[model samples]
Target: MSHLLRAEYGPRGRSAGASTWHVVRAADPATALCGRTMDTDAETRAEEEWGTGLRCCQQCGSLYMHEVPHMEGSHPYS
Candidate 1:
């Protein structure tokens, strides 16, 4: 089974203070991982085992978590 986690960030670069929602695959929903606290510099990170981890501004960063689901084909946003 898989679960999804939701994270909210301030913003990044030009689009600072933007809001974005990210859908990530997880092994268990009971696990409190990303919701604990906000790591300012945690824009990029490595996952442990069950799933992947990301750190970026949901609104203004070059990369975002909310864009994961809408992506289609070999490339995203063609």
Candidate 2:
């Protein structure tokens, strides 16, 4: 089944490569800011850089995010 995901822009931190993009489950798109449930590790990706925010999956109550474009491939963080 297709799930509704929300993308929020995270600010850069004091450390380098700390900026991230968060993707959370929109349980109540009209009212829910993040999600009502927590995600199991199995449902999350290892490469995701988590910050302060809530995420959930409709099917498993899980959440994950993709690595920043510059952090992936051969481009290194400077």
Candidate 3:
């Protein structure tokens, strides 16, 4: 698996705050690993893993969890 990048895109529905984070690539900025396209220029990127509260792309989440692992003592849950 390749290195995973987490980014947030907004306006999911009626609420402007309704944004979903997804796994994307540095090469393909507009496309998520789950195959959704968003305006990459407007997206806010997460440091490493995605934020906790924002919803995640199911497919991308599954793929990301497997691709990028939390090193021992690195994450809160670890």
Candidate 4:
């Protein structure tokens, strides 16, 4: 289950990292691994660039963990 790094912007300041990075399956941009509808127009980033410090979607991180257990600690921005 390959995932792509993208962005999910919600209400302004109405979230805990809601405007952070999101994870979407490489095959689909319709919805993210966190179950949030993704913005198809959003540009996706390479998995290598999903490093720390950036805001990341928690739900996506959880789901991604199950998707790739070996890649633990790879999901940044928790």
Candidate 5:
């Protein structure tokens, strides 16, 4: 897990390691912000709001981003 959690850089840019799972659950943005559903859509609008910049789970309706960093380099801000 530690090895897999290395910084990954692609065309878009750098991203979390393997162990650092980025889960996107289907949900409603409005309802999620208020703590309701948890679904994610592949739409441009939703994607913009729930951009890859996210490093944490934002329970907006159902859409969300789960970023689990390594204990050694778990920088939530970066």
Candidate 6:
């Protein structure tokens, strides 16, 4: 049960509102345990657990998420 998450990246002095939204694939709740106290919400937990490795954009110093495309062969209709 992977989940979708939003990660942000922007200039140092900029507010979160000025940041860009990146849609990321997050681990399922059953797999995201870092031995720390859990957040009240799932989104925050996913961000904290998996957001560390996201790379910043070189051109704009912004971070973005990559969405995994659905493979046609995996779909029953295909």
Instruction: Identify the candidate with maximal TM-score.
Output: 4
Per-model TM-score versus the true fold: 0.23, 0.21, 0.59, 0.68, 0.18, 0.26
lDDT of 4 by residue, 28-71 (tens): 96688878888787667765555566677888878876776665
Which portions of model 6 miss their true places by more than 4 Å? 12-18, 28-77
In order, the Cα lDDT scores of the candidates are 0.35, 0.32, 0.63, 0.73, 0.30, 0.34
Model 1 Cα lDDT, one tens digit per residue, 1-78 = 233434445545324532333333344333223343433332322222213334433332222233343335656545
On a 0 to 100 scale, what is the lDDT of residue 22 in model 1? Answer: 37
lDDT of 1: 0.35
Q: Where is model 2 poorest over a 10-residue stretch in terms of lDDT? A: 38-47
Q: Which segments of candidate 4 are over 4 A away from where they belong?
A: 10-18, 71-78
**Candidates 2 and 4: which is better by lDDT?**
4
* Rank list by lDDT: 4, 3, 1, 6, 2, 5
TM-score computed on alpha carbons, candidate 1: 0.23
The alpha-carbon deviation from the true structure for residue 39 of candidate 2, after best TM-score superposition, in angstroms, is 20
A best-first ranking of the candidates according to their TM-score comes to: 4, 3, 6, 1, 2, 5
The parts of candidate 3 lying over 4 Å away from their true place are: 1-15, 47-51, 72-78
Better of 1 and 2 by lDDT: 1
Error of 5 at 49 (Å): 6.4
Against the true structure, candidate 2 has what lDDT? 0.32
| Residue 64 shift from truth in candidate 1, angstroms | 14
User: Residue pairs in steric clash, candidate 3?
Assistant: none
- Model 2: per-residue Cα lDDT over 1-78, one tens digit each: 123333332344323332322244334333212333332221332223334343433222323333133345665543
Candidate 6 lDDT: 0.34
